[model samples]
Target: MPDSKLRLPPEAVKKQHSLVWRIILYFALSSITLSVIVGMVLATWNYHRQTEAFQSRLDYIEAGYTESLGSSLWFYDETQIHTQVKGIMNLEDISYVRVTDNLNLDIETGTRPHHQDIKTIELVYKNKPLGNLQVAFDRQAVLTEASQTAIMMIIAQLASLLLLTSLLVFVVHRLITSRIRDMALEVNERIDSNSSEALSIPESAVHDEIDILIHAFNTLSEKMNNELKQKTRAQQQLKQVNSELEDRVEERTQSLQTTIDELNHALKALNKTQGKLIEAEKLSALGGMVAGISHEINTPLGLCITIHSYIDDHYQQLKSGFDSGQITKQDFSDFVAIMDESLGIMDKNLQRAAHLIKSFKQVSEDQTGEHIRDFSVKDYLNEILETLSPKFKKTRHQVHIDCSEHMRMSTYPGAISQVMTNLLMNSLIHGFENKEQGNINILIAEEKGNAVIRYSDDGKGLNEEAKQKIFDPFYTTKRGQGGTGLGMHLVYNIVNQRLQGDITIEKDCGCEGACFRLIIPKKLDVSDS
Candidate 1:
């Protein structure tokens, strides 16, 4: 019995001690359940009765007040109609009352209920049909009454249940629980002292189940005592084996922890390396733009210089002719014309150089910092294209921008510039690889409070494999021929993370080229950035 008790689940032992309470609780729960079922049935019946009474009240109102209401409405007596509807509002469960005539005169009182318990009664005056009267009934009153009755019923049933449970607890404790509790206490004391004494049975008791239980317990106690003596020796041996195993497990755990720490360190290093690579890619693009802009600026600056030299030489000639007193009207006029033409050419070249410089400066600043500012989308795209004009000047690739002038956004323009730059560069380098001529079209529009950009190039489009892995870092078709493969990946990151937007390639775009679609919010939240 002791071994079996040890093997029994903890809940079984708890139930043994709480046997009396469990029985009382079971009895109370069953009684409460039966009471609740009866209460619900009574409440349902009362609710139906109340509903019928409410309907009868509506019928009474129609029979009693319909004629007076119609007569008041027919005479166009607004005061009388209002008075009659107000009286109707005083009835029980009547939430709202409204009277309307054929002349579109509407008189209503009280607030309408949310539930649709409305009744419409047609008004008739002297055998002629007038407008109708609408009465809205409140069903909450019926529910409230039913709830009150059920609550009272529950209170009465609970009182009866408590009385019965108390009586049952007293009977069960005297008859059964007291003996069981004594046995439990004796067993606990013996187990704590490692003794196997038999439980004491009542001397006056008959040889019933309780006495039989005591005999069985005594037999089990003797056998358990013998088993305990044998188990004591085996437990001592197990302790030594367990001690050795614990040391081996501790050593293995330490080795595993060391490997985990090394793996974590390696992962951190790898992530750091990846970040550095992404930064290097951005810097490389910036450096290329710097080189391109510098080369572009030289041409206009060179023109300006040549025009200045020509103007100076002509001025010297004009001064010499005037000093020698041999300057003709035609000569003077011709020198004026030459000076005018040279100055105009110089001014034009200088302005061209200045415009180029301004565009480069803005693009460079935006690329270096993530600043939020309001900018016209069309104007910004123009500025970006101007900075990239040097790349397209030699190619037959015509770039077109289609966007609304009023469309604007407040976001990280640097990220936008980077994305545009990468896309244009990709088109020029890979899309238009060996082709002499290609067309790139950019269409920008506002869609659902977001800026949508569709950029397509009429160059060699991507295949299934290339399209699938196009935005993956370090993936490029031109791996050996100077393709860093980070352009599109950078664009993807900028659009998704920085701009809080999405970009997708239009798979079945009718054009025989790659079409990339970008959807970015017009106004970015600071927290999102």
Candidate 2:
């Protein structure tokens, strides 16, 4: 048949084979097919039995008619043969009947329904063959009856099958499908709700496989819920621990920050104190200078007074001699000579005093004040050494100045003086601390539009550490011995900041003492200050 089953669409086949529909279809098809097969068997058997009974009746009738007709045929009576054959034909389903004699003479009545449906018999008289008879049965009535019986049987069987199938489907739906749907719904509800509550399926007194499935799911759900609860508890504990840790960390950070701020505040205060201490030390040095210069000026003033006294006395005596005319020419000349000599002595003493006063005044003014002025490098350095004489006076240490006398700079005189003074004092105190004699050298020159000074002392030089921190404030080698540590630091500040230049410890200067080189602009940019 052209693979008709395979020609069906896949979707159609799937629908045909669906569980519920397939069940119903299978039940219907099997019932109908079985009903058809059984109906056919029963109908065939009934038709065959009825047809045999009719054939038996026809055979008895045919025998009696054949006997009576055979006697007539022996008498050669055609009327009697025709009458008996006609009687057999009038019977139901007898389409045709025929009789024949020994002489081959035949008599017939009615047309045969079909040649293939004919039945034939031989008539015998006294055990001798007399003639033959043939008859055909009408098959349409038997076929009609058999067809009706088969249809009725098929209808009855189909109705009963349909009822039985419906009952089975209903029972299966009730027993299995409904329970499965309810369980599925419950599972969906449990998932959607995500509740801690366990799933519940109503159970009958008689339990089945679904109950076992529900029990397994319930056990699993309980385990999951228990685990979920444990996880929640652990998370809450972890969150609490994290909160505690964060608080502790914040507290620690705050403590560290407070300590840092306090340290910074203390550091600022210490720096301010250091600056004040440096200034105090500078003033203390100035006070000592003042005392020394006072002692120095006293000597010159004493010489001037003594010289004035002598000159006044000589002038009075000479005036007296000249006015009274008792003086000889030689006496007058001697008086004039003596007076001139006295005047010379007085003038010399006064000049000496003036020079001392001038030097002291200029040095003091430069140290105590700030002003830019033109000054000879050699002369100004001599004045500074002179003012600082008292420091070296007690010891055998001597300071030497070497510079171009003609080299003058237009710069901060006071700042320069202070820088030189601090350097000198630092050498006297620190460089020559325990020495009996030391030589201090201050060399000045002009280089690249700047005044360069190389100050060194032939005393115990500084070590590498001291040389590095020598310019740092409050970094003293003599901390407990009233060493303020500001001398070199002040020198550095004055040279670098006020003079707009730089200073360095010249390690390669080939000196046994610490050689400090200062370069100051000849004309300072005061605006930078």
Best by lDDT: 1
| lDDT, candidate 1, 257-319, per-residue tens | 999999999999988987888898899888888888898889989988888898889889889
Task: Report the lDDT tens digits of candidate 2 across residue range 1-529.
Answer: 0122443345434442355557778888888889999989988987897799778867788667767766776777787778778888788777677787678688777775766777777776667778888887767777788889999999998889878987977776677655665665666666668765656776666778877777778888889889999999999999999999999999999999999999999999998998788778778877888888777777767876876787678668777877997667787677678768777877776776677678778877777777788888888888877887766778999888888868998887878778888788878887887889989888888888988888899878999899889999878899999887788888888787778899999988888887988888887776876
Q: Could you tell me how far off, in angstroms, the CA of residue 120 lies in candidate 2 after the best superposition?
A: 99
lDDT of each: 0.86, 0.79
State, as a TM-score between 0 and 1, how close model 2 is to the true structure. 0.49
Steric overlap count per candidate? 0, 0
Off by over 4 Å in 1: 1-255
Q: What's the residue-level lDDT of 462 in candidate 1?
A: 90
Model 1 worst lDDT window (10 residues): 1-10
lDDT, model 1, position 281: 86
